[model samples]
Target chain A: MVMSCRDRVLAAINQETLDRPPVAVFTTCDTIGMMKASGASWPEAHSDPQKMATLGCAQADYFGLESVRAGFCLTEEAEALGCPIDMGTSHSSPMLKGHRNKYDPMKKIYDEPNDLPDIDVFLNTKRVKTTIEAMKIMKKTHGEKYCVVGGNTGPFTLCGHLLNTENLVYSVWTDPKEAQKWVAAIAPYCKAFGQALLDAGADIVQMSEPSASTDILAPSDFPIQSGQFVKHALGDLTGHTILHICGDSAPIIPFMFDTGVTGISVEEKVPPEKAVKIANKRGALVGNVGCAMPLYKGTPQEVAKAARASRDAGFNVISAGCGVPIGTPDDNIRALVKAITG
Target chain B: MNDKKLLKELADSVVACDPNRARIASEEALKEGIDPVEAINKGLVIGMGVIGNDYAEHKIYLPQVLVAAHSMYEGLNVLLPAIPKGDLSDAKTAITAVVQGDVHDIGKNIVKTMLTAGGYIVNDLGKDVTPSSIANTAKETSVNVVCLSTLMTPTMDSMQEAVKLINDNGYHKNCIITIGGPPTSEKFAKEIGADHRDDDAQSCVKYVNSKMKKEVK
Candidate 1:
């Protein structure tokens, strides 16, 4: 019997045995093709729940992928927390304009995280609420057939959004205790927002903490600076969760698993075989495809080759190494799905 | 302390990520009659170069790199004004910018710091810079290198546009254009008509230096 898309994904997350892992994008995958197919583009769909749901599900509807995700960018929490944002055109994802609070490393001054809005107020903020509502709509419309994934900024990254990331990182070296205080203060909001997504019908909360990636934080510092806080913000969630850290996460794969997440997503910087070996069945493994290369710029043949390699490498879910670029070619995505499902 | 000790102190302060120590060391180097340019090149620059290499090798990460960059800047603030005004006129010039539609500039900032440490007169156009502005800056300044960066794939088009503008305006012949950031690759660089691409700031600067040396030959 053929397993349902929803069942396949849940099974993959559970690390259950399957003939073929489902082809899904746990990260943001809203493409131009998706926009055209759904008639819901960015900068507008990013705000409208119905449009967001339409665009989010366009992946499964148009490309034959098995999971749906929403909130194309990581700035939702940052924007809701008071950072000015430039909601870019259909071609560009949302970009953070500036930090909401003072965090000048050179001047050695910073605003305490204590003044952040209450957790309830934060959850109900405009874009944050929009994402939750979109999750609900996606669940109602397509959740039975496909998993509805809710993407959110991780706590360390959210803290960086409020305070300047460079400044926060500088503190990690000169004054680590101060940096921990701010990240700890900001984590509850991450947890609350994640729980809200789950409550609103998202099957998985994929938290992207790019700021805490091995590229920025030393591996030794991950546990204290980001991993522990992430354990609370993501691990403590009532539903399944996946933690994504950009760059070569080979160094911190174990640390990421220690967060108690149901799965972890990594970028192509880590070799696919190396990632699986390092993961060692810690949990569900979801990626290794080069989003920039074969997916957006290379041919469909290259995309298929990559997809098969990920499957052969023993990844639980075949997905993008990172958020699928908005301009990724439709043929490449279709090739990825067909490579695995066929 | 002796002049040699003071210079070593300046480098040590930066590597140690202590801005105040770097500042004091810079002042001491000046008091000991060490040339400010030598203090920068032999001291602060050496320290930053070590940090940059460590970052490239993953021996250290961004936090240490940022702090070390901050410390170097603190020392530079002390030593720069003391240098004779025209001493830097022959220094190679470079332009760095985060392309339009992307505001994540941590990578760009690191490149800028590395270029500055490498003795380039880096004109940072800051974040969310338009492609036109980048091209115009390269043309107007006659820079020896143009470094473009954006962390988002959506903004890769902006980087491509900036490179095209530089090429269309005939500035590519005069300057080497390099692109960095997670989304960019050597393939993307070649596709966009850029001269080079690198994953880390140290390699970017090293590439520019090697190319400039070949040009001088």
Candidate 2:
């Protein structure tokens, strides 16, 4: 008999072949049914160790997936660092509230990597520490059974929230060096945060860095802009690592391989075959589902077909090409399972 | 101010986004005595048609394209005032909004700016607007076109519902209702019954303009 689902996933993470490909579901704690079942609630569930561990365990049973990751939005690190997010509603993800200049007026963002508006708040903030604890507990509970993926906001994405993007994009044109200074300030947060999870028994660390993605930035600036720092920091971490960027990154797909990530998650807007071919040349790939289509609106059978298509396209794991929407139907996951096991 | 120079200049004005220069050029062409319709069509509208293509190609960014449309608007704004009133052969109205529940207004704003640049009097409803507001406004304002945008997947259903509400209530019978955004698709448009769908803000102006047809005499 197999040792455990956890062992299976860990072996898979190290690129060791297994009975089947490892599956990971990127989810947020806000899911209605999951929260109700696990009795975990936000801010607390986000930072509470037991609640996070329980919730993390529920991921496999809930979605029949191979990996369960902690933390949904990269905004938390930025929010911890003193940004006010317009959390919008119970349903939506938080967004930086004001124009970039309104809060972070100071240029060259190196003000001692405080995870919150003040240095003290970050130190006390329970979520980061809670999440790490949850990872350890998850390992204790399922470490023998499943793969646990821990996540951190990349340096540039964290800084994008901190410094604000309004001036960042324009400044990219006017002054490259100044932008670099702002980006460099947040590197410590990602490194520390990533290290926290690794220390807690996370088998793989995922960097959810949207700002580094080409959707918002020119491909030419990706490497030195932020990728280099992540490559080094995550490289030093004990577990295998993956980098996920949202949106079409056709122009930068080939170059992204140089970042040293064991895997990359690109969105469906990118042709899966192209991404697969690129990944085949560079490394492993996880997704390219038309997230908006099957995951959000398509029927279970249609979603299963989409899963088959993803497999045909040559992905190692079939998942939402982007973050799984909270509104996603339960049947969608079932369809993915049906497609995979079939 | 012959037919050739006037239209060419109007087209040039839409590209340059220089309203002041465009107005002066249109006036000079008029003084030199050119066919107003020819100048508006061959020069201004036609030039914007090309800019729409470039905008889609990413050959030109927002600032350049918006300013170019502004130049056309300036020239048209001047012409509208000078046109022999009541015989307004080139006036058009359009209503644009960044659908309710979505906060991303930058794209909607750009589309409004482009429409204005292309000589269409646009009703900018700002952002987070409900379908009822759009439909009621369409009825009251007698807009020739209605454009709705939503940037979120959660709100995409609302966008689809907005179009359905408009059509069910007969709002679409009066004016063409359309939608666009990152999540929108031709299939979505067909399922929900949007009269038109545009992937580019600049192209939307052209689509609306093309729908106008031989301005009511």
lDDT tens digits, residue span A3-28, model 1: 89999999999999998999999999
Interface RMSD of 2: 4.0
DockQ of 1: 0.87
Instruction: Please identify model 1 stretches exceeding 4 Å from their true place.
Output: none
> What would the per-residue lDDT of candidate 1 be over residues B136-168, giving only the tens digit for each residue?
999998899999999887789999999999999
Distance from true position, residue A17, model 2, in Å? 3.3
Name the lDDT of candidate 1. 0.92
- The lDDT for every candidate, in the order shown, is 0.92, 0.67
**Model 2 misplacement above 4 A:** A27-56, A99-137, A162-167, A211-214, A224-226, A229-238, B1-52, B58-96, B99-101, B123-142, B164-170, B214-217
The 10 consecutive residues of candidate 2 chain B with the worst lDDT sum are: B60-69
